[model samples]
Target: MAQELNQLEDASIVKELQRRLNEKSASLLEMEQMTRRLLSLNEQIRHTETIKSEFISLIKTEFRTPISSLLQESQQLVENIGNTDVVATGSHLHQQLLRIDFHMKNIFAAAELEAGETRNAYVKVRLESLIEDALAILQYVVKQKQLRIESTIDLPEGTLVTDAGKMQLVLMNLLSNACEYSYGGDTIRIRGTVEGDRILVSVEDPGEGIPEEHLEHIFQKFYQYHSGKTRLQKGLGLGLNVARGLVDLLGGSVHCTSAPGGKSTVFTVSLPLKDDREVKDTSDGGNDFMFEAF
Candidate 1:
């Protein structure tokens, strides 16, 4: 009996040792997984830092030319005061100033949005005038690309009232992107119409349409198509992201539709004019502004 008891004690000790060894192996596996996760997070941080640096460099490059032009143009106006056509030179100066103003406003707006300092200033503004002004602001860009702006705002005067500044920014970004993505001499269509209590504005561009896989990701902050479109266009990739954020804040939604090849890309923004409840649809198909690939 004493021999049997001694054997049982030995068995218990071996079982205990096995349990501890198993626990140690599991702990080592967990540690290895944790280390891998940590390495992945570090790599992401490095990538974010690199993108930010690129954005900063792009901003500097964008500002330098216009600022330099403003200086030179003003100096020329002062020196050759009588020789220069006062009206034409003044118009040139105004355009240059507008370009600077546009950049400053967009950059500041983006910064403010990043800092969560967004606040709406609601005031009465005409929809037609607002759109025309956005187009006017982007005139230089359009002219550079040789793109045509075929705008039609059908909403009646004083019918649409919202945060004009934010709306203008939304329009500006959309228009800018339209011009950027379109080929030279392509026509950009901007249409605004009232469907019940909702204002639907769509901007269409006839450039190389966004890929089917990339449509879902275009609005992600600083997201650019690195493969097919990186060489075709250059941007900070903040425009669409900012546009969508502002739309959401303003109780509106933005949608995009594009074909596969070099067909066309379209973005539709639906803003609530008054009612926040369900948009009353009269048609059998439902929503008037369904995203249709052109």
Candidate 2:
């Protein structure tokens, strides 16, 4: 009887040891999982910080040009108050204001997109009007560069149901990029067409085209292609990304193709034809005034 009891006690001790070992194994697994998660979070935080730094640098670079121009123009106007050609100085100031507004809008839109707060308000809008508005806004830039814009609108004057505001932003970015990269006297061609159930718009420039490898990553946020010791152009590198995002929100696709030897490039946007039945009512007045031409 004594031996049996002793054997039972030994068995109890072994079971308790097994239980403790199982608990320890589970605890170790949980700890490993927690550690992996923490590492992943840390990596994400680092990436976010890197992106924030790059974006801030780009913003400063982009703002410098326009702000300097504004300051110089203002000083000239003040110095020559009566002697300066009022019309010319006023026009210059107007252009500078437009440039500042354009950049500010893009920056705001990019922030909204990053925060995932941007929403599309679809309305029946003429594509031509949007294109014209964008061109008008960038007219000063084009004149400054001695660039010519050749536009061919193949679609009928029929209004398309879409987010006119966002679409305007998209077209502006494309046209702005074209003008920014093209050399003096270069012609930037814009063409719009209706293909099947989609509206296709293309902005082509005879500038230094993007490289094959860089083309794929051009639409990524904060992505800029560095060429040798300098960058291909001066920008916040948010235009294409914001444009792509707006296009996607409108249920469209954007793509690019470049000619060999970086001689030319084309950015195309394809958007679905609006179905009237699916249109949403956004009648409540909002910030449409912000996008209006000054």
Candidate 3:
């Protein structure tokens, strides 16, 4: 009986030992999972910090300079009332305000897109006229940089039907970027052509070429290869991202490719000839698309 009881006590101890070991294993796995989660959260925090810094720098240069110029330009016109041409000053003022307006529009558009509040309006749009209007918005920037424009538009007016406002914004973003990136004294090409019921528009700039790695990430919001106040390029970093979103919403796609010999970058937008889907109410109370004089 004593031997039997001793064997039973040893068996109980072994079973208890097995239970404790299993509990320890589960605890270890949970700890490992927690550690991985912590690591992931840390990486996210770091990325957000970098983006915040870039946004601050972008606002300082992109907005502050133009607004300060508006004030200075007005003061100069006032100080030399007869010396400065009234029409020229007014035009300058108009361009600066246009810059601000475009910038604000992109920001709000991006937000609406993120929140999915954008209303899509389907209409017959003039492809040729849209290109012309994009050029007008950036006329001052092009002249300031002494950049030459070589454009070829084979598209007839009202050839394509899609979201007119989104289309204009995409063109404006692409043209503005070309103006910003092109080397002074170099010519930028804007071309539109049709192939098999699809429309293709390309904007090529003779700027320092984008690296292969940077090309992939260029369309990411708040992403810049070089950031901070000293970076050569200044933007909200939303231009390409917003363009891609609007293009996708319009049932089109946009991509960037390096020009032959690699000293230039070309951004090409591809779209179908028509989207026959029923139109819905506008989400943001946005203005109707209108052509701007170049």
Top model number, TM-score: 1
Instruction: Write model 2 residue lDDT over 1-294, tens digit each, in one string.
Output: 999999999999999999999999999999999999999999999999998998888778777877898888888888887774867987888877887788888888887777787666677777778888898888787887888888898877554777878889999999988888777788999998889999999999998778888988999987876553212346777789999988988899999999745478899999998777756675575324235322
- Could you tell which candidate, 2 or 3, scores higher by TM-score? 3
Model 3 misses residue 135 by how many Å?
A: 1.5
The models' CA-based lDDT, in order, is 0.77, 0.82, 0.79
The residue-by-residue lDDT of candidate 3 on 1-294, one tens digit each, is 999999999999999999999999999999999999999999999989988887878878888988998998888787777774766987898898888888887888788779877655776667777777877877778888788988898877666776778888899998888778776777989888888888998999887767787888999998754423222347798989999998988778999986433388899999888654544344654334332122
| Candidate 3: regions farther than 4 A off | 1-19, 84-88, 227-233, 259-262, 275-294
RMSD of each: 7.9, 4.7, 4.0
Q: Report residue 206 deviation for candidate 1 (angstroms).
A: 0.7
Name the candidate, 1 or 2, with the larger TM-score value: 1
Off by over 4 Å in 1: 84-90, 226-233, 275-294
RMSD of 1: 7.9
Q: Rank candidates by TM-score, best first.
A: 1, 3, 2
- TM-score of each candidate structure, all chains considered together: 0.84, 0.77, 0.82
Q: Model 3 clash pairs?
A: 119-283
- The number of the candidate with the highest lDDT is 2
Worst 10 residues of 1 by lDDT: 285-294
